[model samples]
Target chain A: MKVMTLNFLTCAVKNCKSSNDSFPLHPKEAELAKDDIEINPQLLINVLPRIDWAALRTTSTELGFPTLPEQPPSPEDLQSDEALLKELHELLMETQMMEGKLVCGHCGHEYAVKNGVANFLLPSHLV
Target chain B: MLPTPDTSHVPYNRVYEPAEDSFLLLDTLSSPSETAFLSSRFCSTSPSSPSPPNFGAPLVLEVGPGSGVVIAFLTAHASTIFGTPHVLTTAIDVSPFACAATNLTVRKAVSEAEAEAEAENPSTSGQWTSAIQGDLVSPLRPGSVDVLVFNPPYVPTPGLPAPPPAPLQELRDKTTFEEDSHLLELTYAGGKDGMETTDRLIDALPGVLSERGVAYILLCAQNKPEDVKGRIRSMGTGTGEGEGWKAETVGTSGKQAGWEKLQIVRVWR
Candidate 1:
């Protein structure tokens, strides 16, 4: 799973939908792999508005990337700053979570990730 | 016509093979009218403009992308279909094999498209986020999805098979024939008029989709396409405001004596 995917994922448990802690499932024992993808500044800029910056910051820190700024950079800021654009690209596009467990903060349910695919199927009891 | 994504590598034993229904989706999405609708909804208003303010890239989610031919086609030919490459794609399936197969299918299509583009003018394909194993749209954040596609288990059957247990899903070794059969059943057997699964997905649409979200769902004759559209039209967009949902038949195939065998319904606010 790409780091960017975490921003749109939440605890599959029905009750967790309304919980604030469930927005960004925390990565634990994550194995990261970096792909040599050419950066596309336009894509990054366009995707910025849809991204939940606060959740991304949490995911970035959990994955051991350097702490991101308190606020997401503006589209204009990203367009002119090559280094910042590359950093965002590396975290969101190039970096892949090959193996790990995504633990939902509210229910503490651990969704296992093996071979880059995260299993979000809850057990019978949880479901 | 845009090239269809290659799904030759996908194992048909457990994954749903690309069939008439899948081909219909490809044809429908890339059709001129649907392309115009998608581009207008997702693409930047001014093509020449660099980056329009608040114009976020649309996220395309495919529920149960069995062999992944449909989603792969959308991702690979995004610029041609959606008129922009700034689109994000992902998939969710109950079967782990389908999820794995989807990842491979999307990657192969994107790379092939990239290679072809390299020889000519530069072209950018949409980004594929990831394929997660889950039931329907249960794992997605509410109001996050922009464009949702589903090729569901629309074939009427006696009863719906239960999804694979977590332990079974974890098995990495070769599956037994019975196990494979069961996995394949999850792709087509839709208990109770084939609306058992599609109904749940329809209910989730209001919650799973964004304000600008749209969905293209495939339904067969047995599923009562008009009634389904009526049900969708009556529901709210989950925003508690604006007009009720809208649904219309955008594509059809396998006509039999004036009866539409299978149809694709586009649902939106």
Candidate 2:
């Protein structure tokens, strides 16, 4: 029963290049789940308490998190939302995806994550 | 867990006394006792490394040093154990109180060592390591160290209502969750996601590590032990793998409620 919304409001909009760190995730990179990683269950469950349920639902979508039905989750929702929850789980949890590339939501930046390692550094002008 | 000079109960962002009771709270950590082993392991690597290229003059750097005690310990034994001719230690911290404490403690350690060295060599007492503010070094020089040690703020969740006074508060992060920004103190808290500071440390290490240089990091529950391994694995130098740089859990830091089961992890690179 966690809801999150994309809060691009707080990001450093000073420039588009603030989001390209790969190895150590840059603070500004859009938080989305990749193929080889899974969302942390504890972080997801814990965030259920601290985050805005409605906002979470909205932002996860914009951030490319899987979508679920609008009907309020029930006592059995944890079981029903299993598939979507896993998707949401990956969205909220901190993960180190070694393979694939991270696409930027703000800028058209694609950072590569290979061998469980991501190269986040961009060229000087991009920086 | 401790009171600042002002005795305010409000917590987070305050510098607490370094006594065993003040900061060693085990409320969030699984087992502080196990963590004590981590701290010991974090420290033990200094003696295990093959002598560095500069055995004649060992230059050591420490970051986020609280009271200079750890450096003092390393410098004291480095010569005999690490084959260092003379150790030049530099302890870095943002807190003036901590820096002063580090200066005094290092000097005291040097004097004590000099007292011992006087039995054989007279020059031992005069060479004391330098302590400066962290800002002094911007984007720390690349590959310039024999042993680099750091014990950052590794508190899991600094839920205390109010922050501590100046100097100490400067050491902690001023960011609130609303900001979604990071603070040095929050790095200690590790938040719901651990490795808050460890991530930054990892990003910085690539530039700081010397070829074949040794690094020691002290971590608590704020960091995920596995991630520490993961990042170390990513280093790709082949130094941290296969049981070489182990993050062993150390025992309690001698506190009251929390630290009895805290795990302090040490990373060597």
Candidate 3:
């Protein structure tokens, strides 16, 4: 899973309804891989408003790519700053979570990412 | 253009390759009138303009994008023709193989589109596509999806096979590629009236769609299109529901003489 996708995914437990820390599932024991895909700067700028800047920064730092600034660039700055856009692109698209555990902040449930696919399935009891 | 995968690859053998129903879905979405409607819906200006300002591209999710043909086709065209700022496309399927295949297919389509755009204008950017493994829309947020699409397993099965085992344990057991291929066969195993899965998504539509969101679902004769439309039109009120959903038969395909007819039902509130 790419960091951009992880940003939108929340814990899937049926009972975990509060939109609190359920999102930006903390990646534990993450193994990263460079996908070598071309970066799309305009796409990055478009999604900037929807992303949670703080959560992304925390996750990126944990994954050993601390490229995001403490404060997200303004929309205008994001478009104009080529370096910043490239960094965000590298973090969001190129870096892949090959193997890891995404632990939900609210329920403490772990969603495993194996072979580059994050299985967001919950147990029947939880469902 | 309706995207068709070069299915000579090994991984594609495990996926439910596109068929008549798939083409019908494509025809519905790409028809001149529908294309015009979508161009207007997704783009505020013509495609030649530079970075169409803040045209917040709608979030499009496709359920059971078996080979990702339809989603990728939509992404390629939607981004290219509308000059959309982004095509935030997501594809979901219960089978792991389907998810992988979808991601691959979408990546190829988006890359090709981006390459063409770059050749035309040296400074063009691109789009993003993600294929997820989940049942229905369970993993997605409610009332957030803007363009929901589903080409469900509408071919009726004898009965609903037991839902797959826990994902992690099942993943652990799928040590062989052949074992994984077996699951792909269930892509068309829709239980009872072939509406089992389709019906559930219809029931969930009111909660799944954004206020102005729209859904395009492919239904066949086996699914009882008329009755399904009635059910959708009466799915209660509030939130995603706005004066009840308006259903229209956007397009249909297959022999009129037989029961092979497929219809694309466009639902909006």
Which number leads on TM-score?
1
Q: Residue-wise lDDT of candidate 2 within A11-100, one digit each (tens)?
A: 112254244321111223443334343333432432343233554455555445467456434324654667766765555433323245
Candidates 1 and 3, the one with greater DockQ: 1
lDDT of 2 by residue, B60-158 (tens): 666755555555555554444333324445665544445555666665666566566777865432123345433212213344454566555555563
Mark the 10 consecutive residues where model 3 chain B has the least summed lDDT.
B167-176
Q: Which ten residues in a row have the lowest lDDT in candidate 2 chain A?
A: A1-10
Residues B93-203 of candidate 1 have per-residue lDDT tens digits of 998888889999999999999998987746568999999989899999999999999999999899999889755686356988988999999999989889899999999
Q: How close is candidate 1 to the true structure, as a TM-score?
A: 0.97
Query: Candidates' DockQ values?
Result: 0.87, 0.01, 0.43
| lDDT string, candidate 3, A44-105, tens digits | 76677556688888788878875578898876897798888888888877887778888888
Q: What CA RMSD would candidate 1 show?
A: 1.5
Q: After superposition, how far is residue B35 of candidate 2 from its true place, in Å?
A: 20
Off by over 4 Å in 2: A1-127, B1-16, B19-56, B123-127, B135-139, B158-188, B192-194, B238-269
A best-first ranking of the candidates according to their DockQ comes to: 1, 3, 2
Chain A TM-score of prediction number 1: 0.97
Candidate 3: clashing pairs of residues: none
